[model samples]
Target chain A: MQNVTKSKWWQTMILKTIAMVLIGFIVFGPLMGTLLWSFAEKWFWPAAFPQELGLKYWKIAFTGQSPVLDSMAISITIALIVVVLATLISVPAGYALARFNLPWKRILLVLFLMPQAFPQLPVFINMTSIFYRYDLVGTVPGVIAVHLVISLVYSVWITTAAFKSIPVTLEEAARNLGASRLRVFFRITLPLATPGLIASSIFVFITSFDEFTGTFFIGAPFIQTLPTLMYTASMGYNMQYASVIAILLTIPALLFMLVLEKFLKAEYISGLGV
Target chain B: MQPRAAVKRPSIRVSDGQREAVSGLVLVLPALLVLCVLYIYPLCASIAGSFVSDEGIGLHNFAKAFTLYGTDILFTIGITIITLVLVFVVAVLTASFLRFRNWPFLNFVYRLPLFIPYLIAGHTMRVFLAPHGILNILISRVTGLSDLPGLAFSWIGLVITFVWKQFPLATLLILGAFQSVEDSYIEASLNLGGNKVRAVWEILLPICRPTVLVAMVLTFVSTIGCLTIPLLIGPSKPVMLPIDMAFRINYMGDWGVANALGVISYLIVIALSMYYLSYTVKKEDA
Candidate 1:
């Protein structure tokens, strides 16, 4: 028994060690290269690695010379705006989805779900025409409005799951005792679903913030975002500058993801189960 | 009954009866309006743009599409399929491995790819796979190879970049599904003389089947709409659909042709989504 247990423990330890190494390499390989390239004076052809390193690229990225800082701020602000608006709209809709049995609910659900799969490029192109007509393309609100389509769908899906978890009996009992519907909803349902609401809102923010194609196709040149700026720097052969912006832009997202992993128990839509 | 009689009864409906319905509508109106303006309107406009021509209610745009060398469209469809399959396969394997081992660090590693946005992934791949990038330099130093050929602007490079970008998402979804499998089933399979592979194929696979399907569908949908990977790493020959569509709008200023292609792509997306939804509903019913 001792011998078998020892072998099993040894095997488990070996496997775990291997997994850790692979994981580290997988994550840090490109990241390390990116960091090295960012600090390097020049990443030229035929050089094995950077021989010289300095803060020159970082200085450029931070200064008013590059639009990296401004674009990052715009991207985050837009994402937050979308998150707030999407959560506000989706909470009530999610309530209707979960609690009510309205006809055409299936249709509504499908409509919400379809956008996730739909190709966003064409929609952007066509919307550009409409934006051209209405003069909403160049501004931040125009981009935010377009982003809300995707953000709202995701928000509704997640928040509906959150709202569904509140038991009907609690609300019914409150109503039976002369408590108002608004009172029950605001006091009971909203509080119970707070965690889900928060999780979904963060997801909305992440999606909107990370959005590249729509920001490129519709809000490009005039309203630059971080991803678009990264694309431009890389395309313009400013590898060092691109890497700096890339690392800088990626930090907040990485931090948010880590925090989320701690609280958002990785069940696909866990809040939906009542 | 006696308790009920002792208490005063209250009215169920509020004084602002009609206003409640209006409030609900008011709450939903903005989102619905945006959806109509953005999604529904663009979709309609694209279709209208497709049909507009001097030829009088004819299929001119589609005729143009048919004649305009559909190799790009075909190439894109092929790439989408291959990327989905490869990503799904690799993801399932890695996820299964993680599940079997229950490795903590593996979870973090598997999710790291999600942090890099698609554009960054494309750019990173370009840098790493450039002619004088680490890939070629390593090859030269290790094997004394003079040239590490076909690193950039190649089909193989495009596939590699896409797989790298997409695999992490697939792995996460599959890993989450893998976690849901009970340990008892594995023990049961083992006791029945089944090895890990057999156990995974029979027990674990069936349990996580729905999740795998979801992952596959998402990856397919994502690849179909992608433009960056192909533009970055793909060869000049056999142009991909998204790039082609963009070219039509930008270079040619042919909104009609561009919108026609968009409409076609949208129709395919709708079909795929409907199929996925119907399957899900049926699965639930079953």
Candidate 2:
């Protein structure tokens, strides 16, 4: 029995070590490759690594010559706008859904979720007429509004969980204590659910920031976001420029996720029973 | 508990009329107005345009998109299947590996691509797999081969890139699903003398069946409507549906046909999403 147990333990450790190496390869392979390529000078066929490496492409991408700056700026603006608008729209709606026994809740849930499942291509094509009619195409706000359709759904889903996590007894106690409804809300409820709200907003921001399909359809030739610029740079066969901007755009998202790491527990978001 | 907390204070009361009006305006009015102006109206216009014939009301646009040059449809279907299969197989393996392993840094590394946008992923691969690119160089070095294989600008490369970009998300979802399986079940399987492969197949796989289905459905819908990867690496003969639609609307200025294609893609996506949404909702209720 001792021999069997000892051997089994060793076998399990070996299996674990092998699994670790496999995961390491899977994760870092593409990431390190991209990072290396970003700094390569004339990295083309026949060279395993770049013969000469420099900061030339990074300089161009940061300067006015590269479209990345404008694209990044516009993407940030649009994402923030989407986050705020979605919060405004979803907060009360999510609260009602979570707290009240409202009629048509199921139907409303379906309606709210309908846009998420539907492909953005159809919506983009459909919005062309709106663009022409209202002269809304190619504008940053126009792109932002189109993005809100999806971002709003994300905000609603995440915020619903946030709101549901707030206990009912707290609200009832505040009501009974002669505190006005507004005081109870802004003080107790909002502060308590701030983490969830922030997490949901982060999700909305990421969704809008990384949105490519709608931005391509609406913002082409006019308003450039980071993804759109990345597309154009790559389309022109400027791989160096694309890589530089790709790295630049990825930085902000990674930073945002890191900052919110303490609050936005993956289990919390997933455990909302969604 | 505070003695005052149990009492329902009637001092801070609002009139019922004001309450009703505020509720109506707050809950229903803005949403109804926005839907009318933004979503409902545009969709109606697009639907109408799709049916308008050269002369009058007809299904010419739909017919053209549906039947005219069926190659686009075939290409889209083919690429979608390829992407789905590649992503699923790779994701399952990666997720399984992560579950059995305790490499925190490796887990973090696996998620790096999730932060990178699709365009960046596609473009980086486009460069690295160029004829004179790293992939070909490595190939030549290993085999002592002279001719550089420029496989980057092909269907295989596109599928590979798609799998790389998407597998992380699939792995994460499946990993979550795997974690939900009770440890007792695995212990019981081991006690019964089941081997690792058999235990995984019979115990873990069956338990994670729903999540696996969810992952597959998500992959199918996502790949079927891809615009970036196909545009980047795919050839000219067989264009994916999204690329073809973009060409018609943007390049050729054929809005009606583009909208028709869009509607078809939308229907497929919506059907899949509804299946997932309803399934989850039902599962939660049960």
Per-prediction TM-score, chain B alone: 0.84, 0.79
Query: lDDT at A239 for candidate 2?
Result: 69
Q: Write the per-residue lDDT of candidate 2 for residues B1-286, one digit (tens) a residue.
A: 5555255532223335456445634664454455456666676676677777565677778789878647777677677777877887877776776666666776677776777667767776776666766666767899989776676777777777778788887788888887777778878988999876676677776677677776777677768777887788776667778888888887788877877787777666666567756875676566
Task: Report, for candidate 2, the interface RMSD.
Answer: 4.2
lDDT digits (tens) for residues A56-151 of candidate 1:
989988889778889989998999899888887788888777665444556666677666767777777888888877888778988898788867
Q: Looking at model 1 chain A, report the run of 10 residues with the lowest lDDT sum.
A: A265-274
Error of 1 at B123 (Å): 1.2
Give the local distance difference test score of model 2: 0.73
Question: Evaluated with DockQ, which candidate comes out highest?
Answer: 1
CA shift at A35, candidate 1, in angstroms?
2.4
True contacts kept of each: 0.46, 0.33
